[model samples]
Target: MDYSEAIAIADDVHWVGRYDPGRGLQCNAYLLHTQAGAVLIDPGSMGDFPVVFRKVLDLITPEDLRYVVVAHQDPDVVGSLPVIAEVAPEAEVVAHRETARLLEHIGLRIPIRAVPPEGGFLPLADRTLEFVATPFLHSPGAMATWDTATRSLFTGDLFGAVGAPWSLFAEGAFESQLTEWHEVYMASQQALVYSLDRLMQLDPERVCPQHGSVLVGDQVARANAHLRTLRCGIDRLVSA
Candidate 1:
């Protein structure tokens, strides 16, 4: 498949990936194209992302790719680091401090910058990216990025479902997706509630997750409700 064609949703500030079938163990990667250039977030594993990377390269030259953001260091997320480095050597790899160490241990040569847990912001020409650290949800240095320009959250592995639609939206029913995500992938009820509450404070208008699809319209409201329900459950448990 033409990786360049993988460009899923294009707004005024960014272009994202729509979940593709038979691409990887998950839906592959998300490419954010901005005036500051392109940022490839969680460029799936080598077995999955290489072809997509090549297509991305074909669409935009190295000079156009400003940064390759690896939200977490899981093989599913950072597995295609070497390929991204080769194509866009000028692009710096951004991750949390612990994730950088793990990447180094794995022998990847990409330059990594540690983002603070409280969240640190990176200023790009047209938009600003902020990294929020959320450890142990799935990985050690796991984090999420918020784009101020678009009010979009690039959440890695958070709020993801296994059998999401190709359009990157909930499609027929969101309840099923939410239930499946919580039941299978989410680490713990408490942790999930905390992460959702943290994210709710960000007030993002759009949610682009690593797996499954992107949630656009009414995303913030929907996400907040999900978090609220979980929080209520936790509160009840604590009281009990």
Candidate 2:
């Protein structure tokens, strides 16, 4: 659980989260440095907070952390809100409208910048972060973030896979375990397809999911193609 070293993935973007094989699954949190500030995406579960923060601190101080982007309301996604709030006291939260409401309901007293149903963008001092709504893909308030500068997409749970900690960049074929997890968690086939189409349009160079390794290069396109035909939620229920 000691993810002491922060791995630099792209220009100013670092994978500063822990990878715990003991859990047999893990999530990735990223630190994106901007011109005047920094943004942390999906700070991760409570157990991951200490290690995540330690790695992140190497890149930027907690005080300079300006934005905490929550991709959804899932515990694995935003469970460390309290810890993040403590460290990045001045950081504003950016999430879907419903997610913002959930945060308030949970007694998280932080400034929220909600992304409307149609989705929107957050302007940092250095670049812009685009929010893409992917409702019911798993969570009703699920969303994905695209860093304009790095052309990297931070997908909440959209392209997640389950396995031992793998390569940071995805290689080879899409694991069967990944497709299986999606079949159970994604709320509906329609939602999955819709979100897939929208994300494909963005054509991100890298796809970073919360629970799995990063998908880069040709794997990004291949994964999207695979997701389009896969059935989930009600579709799987009927088939079952």
Candidate 3:
């Protein structure tokens, strides 16, 4: 599916991509517009991103792109970095320190700025971004972003699952969807738990994950508790 056609989730944020059911590889990318410029979070797989990138440029000129934040080094998340640089050369790539090093090791050399795991506040015209380091959730360099003004969290892979419909919420029976996807894709149950506990402290109102639908309202609370339970399950595994 062409992801360039963006779906507006808020005034300045859009979800660009196809969230296909039964597809293990599909995911979502988020576009954040600020007075300073625009930023894209986790551009998704190369095969699934070109349309979205082109569409983004149509809405906002490539030259206006200031940052392309890679929440992790996984190809599914940052695979399109090379393509992004080609189109938006002026934009500086942002990622955690470890992610930067890994990208370099793979010879994907692009100008990248490291945002620490503890947190780094980035000022934007509409809002400020607080990057929270969430190591071991899915990868060592995994991280998440919090938009303070909007109370939205751009959580990389956390609370995500396969088969998220394009409708912005998981379709079908919620429990069935969550259990199957979380258990299969989310390998680090303990890490998920730890991250959820920390994320709740941020008190975000909306969650935009790298995969699946965006969770809001009561769904957010349910997702949080599910993650906490996943952590407990991991703990049992360790004890056993």
Candidate 4:
């Protein structure tokens, strides 16, 4: 794959992540373009910020950026943000309140529009992104964003994987790939299931995780079914 351009996975959501053949894991950043402005999701670490920034610039101007959303305060998810703050200094950050508290410590001067820990939605002039708190899935402040317009769930790390020869879209084996990553990274099965239940209720048409290939069509339902019952973290360790 060329891996030189951003792929539009939805109507206006573009995948702006960098791929590394030297590493097993990778991070993903997304640009949500709207008539009002653009919203960046999980902008990845500082290492990948250069490419990510170039990609964003390819689509929209810095001044047009309205929100910089960090699903969790993990460095990989929020690290590039400090630099991003310098560019789009006026853009408000959207994160869970718990995540917001920790993000502030990073010395980012931009304002944070925190969603309540219980979960809520951020309304934009052209779109509304719903947030779901999936605590302990990856971090205590872990969360997911839902785009109802395209029915694509911007899950922080819920369906992330380390698949070989990574593709922008996942295939039938996506579940097993995701399972390996989740088994070690996710928390107890209860927390995983709780978040999965709420996600299923929304009936997402696609799954766009922060670190893996995008799941579309049936992959959404299939992956959800597999994860809803699969055990991980302490549950898997104990059952073993």
Best by lDDT: 4
Give the distance in Å from residue 29's predicted Cα in candidate 2 to where it truly belongs. Answer: 0.2
Once superposed on the true structure, which residue ranges of model 4 sit more than 4 Å away at CA?
238-240
Looking at model 3, report the run of 10 residues with the lowest lDDT sum: 231-240
Q: Write the per-residue lDDT of candidate 3 for residues 167-192, one digit (tens) a residue.
A: 56554445545565566555466677
Which candidate leads in TM-score? 4
- What stretches of model 3 exceed 4 Å from their correct place? 1-4, 19-22, 106-109, 164-166, 231-240
Model 2, 81-149: lDDT tens digits are 887887688898999998888887666666888899789988887789999999997889889999999
* TM-score of every prediction relative to native: 0.83, 0.94, 0.88, 0.96
Per-candidate Cα RMSD to the true structure, in Å, reads 4.1, 1.9, 2.9, 1.6
**CA lDDT, every model vs. true structure:** 0.68, 0.85, 0.75, 0.87
Question: What would you estimate as the lDDT of candidate 4?
Answer: 0.87
lDDT of 4 by residue, 6-105 (tens): 8888999999998887777788899999776899999999998999999999999899998988889888898898899999977989999899988889
Off by over 4 Å in 1: 1-4, 12-25, 164-166, 227-240
**Model 1: per-residue Cα lDDT over 11-114, one tens digit each:** 64333343346543255466677777788777777776656666576567877877878778887787777877776778888888878878877665557777
